[model samples]
Target: MSSPEKDEIVVQGIAASQGIAYGQIFLFVRSEVEIPTYQVDPAKRIDEVARFDRALVMTRQQIARIKAEVEKNIGPEEAAIFDAHLMVLEDQALIGETIRAFESTGNNIETCFNLVSQRYIKAFSEIDDEYLRERAGDLRDVTQRVLQNLLGQTENALNRLADQRIVVSHEISPSDSATLDRSATLAIVTDSGSKTSHAVIVARSMKVPAVVGVRNLTQRVKSGDWAIVDGYDGIVILNPTESTLFRYGKVQERKKSFESRLLEANREPAITKDGVSVTLMANIEKADEVGIVKNFFAQGVGLFRTEFLFMNAARMPSEQEQFVAYKSAAAALAPQPVIIRTLDIGGDKPLSLQADLFPKEDNPFMGFRAIRFCLEHQDIFKDQLRAILMASAHGKVRIMYPMISGSEEMARANAVLAECMTELKQRGQPFDENIEVGAMIEIPSAAATIDLLAPDCAFFSIGTNDLIQYLLAIDRVNDRIAHLYEPTHPAVLRTLQHIVEEAHKHGIPVSVCGEMAGDPVFSPLLLGLGVDALSMSPAWIPSVKYLVRAMTMAEARALAAEALTLGSPKEIYARCDAFYRARVKMD
Candidate 1:
């Protein structure tokens, strides 16, 4: 009988980062910080509060050091992850609530702070937005550090690894991930995490292979177990057999070769063999990400998510603050258009600052969100428009409104933009008077009525993520029905074609600024459908550009035409996948 060491055990997880690694596992299990709970004497309660303050100060310093190290090692974009952590540290709501909890419960400061922090963590975790929900990890990480400092316990950090090995953990926080030694850390395997988690973001920046949500991976393997991590497929094979190792060795070579090809192609323009040029742009959340946009060779910012500025703040950002942030990205990529999206709050993204304004609803996605929220709250809308307009004076900035259902909504949003332009003029503020306005065609109604709305817009960007979700009536966050949210569904393809056609008829260029735009498999079909541009996460630009450079417009158009005739989404996707695989030469 073969021993357990000879037996191959494979675990499947979500591929958080791309690469391959084979090394001994360094099972990094951090014991939970045990909080001491007891009633504090009335006289010493003030002392407990002071103890909390001291802990906060120490935690802030620790995060600052980590941020500085990350900035030095990785680029400033990755360092911005810690900025959110620092914001959490300085949040008045969290601090005030901790004090209130202590005052009300008369519990030990550690216990009170933990209770208040847990409430905040729970609230964030429950948020429908994936990005916002991932923030719960940041909050949890910060809270644990504060509790540890208050209790005078040192953290179990992965900064000082004995050797290069795969770091296996239940979850790695941004703070812990920041301190990870690149030379000593071979790869990261987490039992719980998502692609959007800050830890995963750090892993990607460090160029380390990472597979997350591996169930109870930590429980199964010892620290010395040898493992093969396939980040491409999100697979981890523990105690791999000789045959399995050989097979994976070949897979690694092919993947590395393909990645090299992608990078080589990324340096070139995204032009088809038929001489048709496609503008490849990036979707950025923060101004700090301008560096990443340039690094990936994205032509411009197709989608600048303004909601992140609000999400990171304790209160609504002032117009001047918003202008400075917008201007930073605009000026950095001067002459390269920065398409600033208006506030897309509601649905999954709710403002903690104005919770009363967005009451819980049965279906928040269709309720008050994006353009509807902006139209109703014109005060907020004008502030953002004014900022975007002001930033345009510094660089090539364009404004786009999200979730426009029809022409009426487009007109209403444009009216607000006009008011901002007028206000800026009265104040003698410099702005691009001809700063173009665009509408996002994410809603099914917007897709159907693009002809009516296109006249009021300078350009159209298809937000396939939400469009597919609404088209299929699928709650993308719902694990049970998420698989039903198919981008290649006949209805989705038809809608996309209709939207592009309608926009073209009105002489407005159309671009896709969604997950579908980045995927190599779907990109050819989109380009074939006559989209003028594609915008996605900066990292994905290279892969999409590679595919574009490999294929001709004639072939892409043929693929799209054939796909339209196919009745099954699987069939359509298979066709697209075949087209991508043939040109990519990964096999």
Candidate 2:
């Protein structure tokens, strides 16, 4: 089928996964499922409940099998999305509500499940935050699985894409995206999705070009029509002219050359021209991402966010499961250190276990979260600690606690770790007796009281992402005030300087593992601040390394000192921008 008009048309969206591609549009129109509602016989209520249970079981098994496949083919990080899906399927709130609906209205099990899932999907879709909004896709993904089981539907249309084509859809769920033939699919264009959506996560993992949140995209393009997907800029050109295609072809070649250079710089040391060596590490959300760290030649896994294990699972992960995950990563980065952070959930990433464990708070970001939650629930806390300690013997694994506010919390947390160590010893289980422990100095209170907290800790990791927001008294997720969330703010710089000074004074190293750490523009300022290490996304390591290799420690220190003297963010940005421009040129 051909498009009505051939004039060049462009649609913009969030640039989810980076790449460039040209292909014929393969419109994936989702025909609405005709769901019928009716009252069931009172005598058959038991059977109704059993039917729902069986369908739920089938859905869970299907997702779990997919999780295993994804873990084997892609990595554990990508497979973690299915864990979240399983949690959604097993959500008590959702299940309870559906059961109540079935009991009250005697409606078909499929109808009740659909109604409850729609309510959740609608609620998540209306959220202002991008992360929460993207969860709507997750709810829908799980809901569809249950519905498919109830209806006995087999396979997604995505599985039928036998030829290479640009996929255009209303929205691609994580499950649907997981079944996609990445080698055959040229690119992805969706009318709805967030940057943090599971679809985007899978696309990034598969290295497929994707453009999401394009309104009415499915309606704009038809099957067999020529299209161009500029994933780098989040633009989709439908019914593209030959000239436009020619231009993008050249652009693709240039991008390939630039990326090749970045990859080539991977094996080189991240050292300054003056011979000052800096540790460049990767901040991974899961153990599977350790492979990327190796690919990028990162010094180590700086921050292994263990929260994914808890947040993604249907229930709390057992000690043995957590042990295997931690061990896998520790073994992957053997000899080099892998700092495994304990579970840090309850704020934006809520636990899936019970309602009382994670209550809805108006300001959850600053509410009872992180170390506070773990401390209150020691059973959960101890399980994680035991797992970390058990995994330590696999390699150079260190333990780090998140959201440390003062010395008291550090002491209490350490006491718990010690208790776990003692128990492991009593059982004659092997573990690293000399495992190092550290604190994540993200809170303003923690930074201010670093002197007291530093002595008890082995190292400090500066979480500038939270530190900046809290220091500036702004919520970065709040778009109206997001502009105020400045990393180069004067107060932010001062706080970082103090944390580094206190940590160094105590003879401990400090690393920046936030968005700023990955930013090439802020590399000199952070280095000058006396930061001992830098940890960021694996993809940014080489570029940041290139920048590190080009400058002398003296130049970086001079730039940092001048930045400290600046009074405003604008001025600080100017200094860093001028220095970065003078030192490095874009390819």
- Residue-by-residue lDDT tens digits, candidate 1, 365-453: 78888888889898998888998899999999999999999999899888888888899899999999999999888999889998899
Tens digit per residue, CA lDDT, model 2, 1-587:
22446777988887888899887888887655567888999999999999999989999999998899888888887887887787887777778888999999999999999998897676556543355568778888888888888888874758678699888899888888888877788888898876777878888888889999798878766788888899878999887777787888888887778677767776788888999999999988778878789988999988988876765455668999999999999998999999988887765556545545777778777877789999999999999999999988999999999988889999999999889999999999999998999999889999999889976788999888888888888987675897788899989998989989978888999999888999889978999999999998888898788888889999999999999998999999999988887876534
Q: How well does model 1 score by local distance difference test? A: 0.89
> What's the TM-score of each model vs. the native?
0.95, 0.85
lDDT scores of the candidates, listed in order: 0.89, 0.84
For model 2 the local lDDT of residue 372 reads: 91
With a 3 Å backbone cut-off (N, CA, C), the pairs that clash in candidate 1 are none
State how far residue 243 of model 2 sits from its true place (Å): 6.9
Clashing pairs in 2: none
Q: What is the lDDT of residue 554 in candidate 2?
A: 97
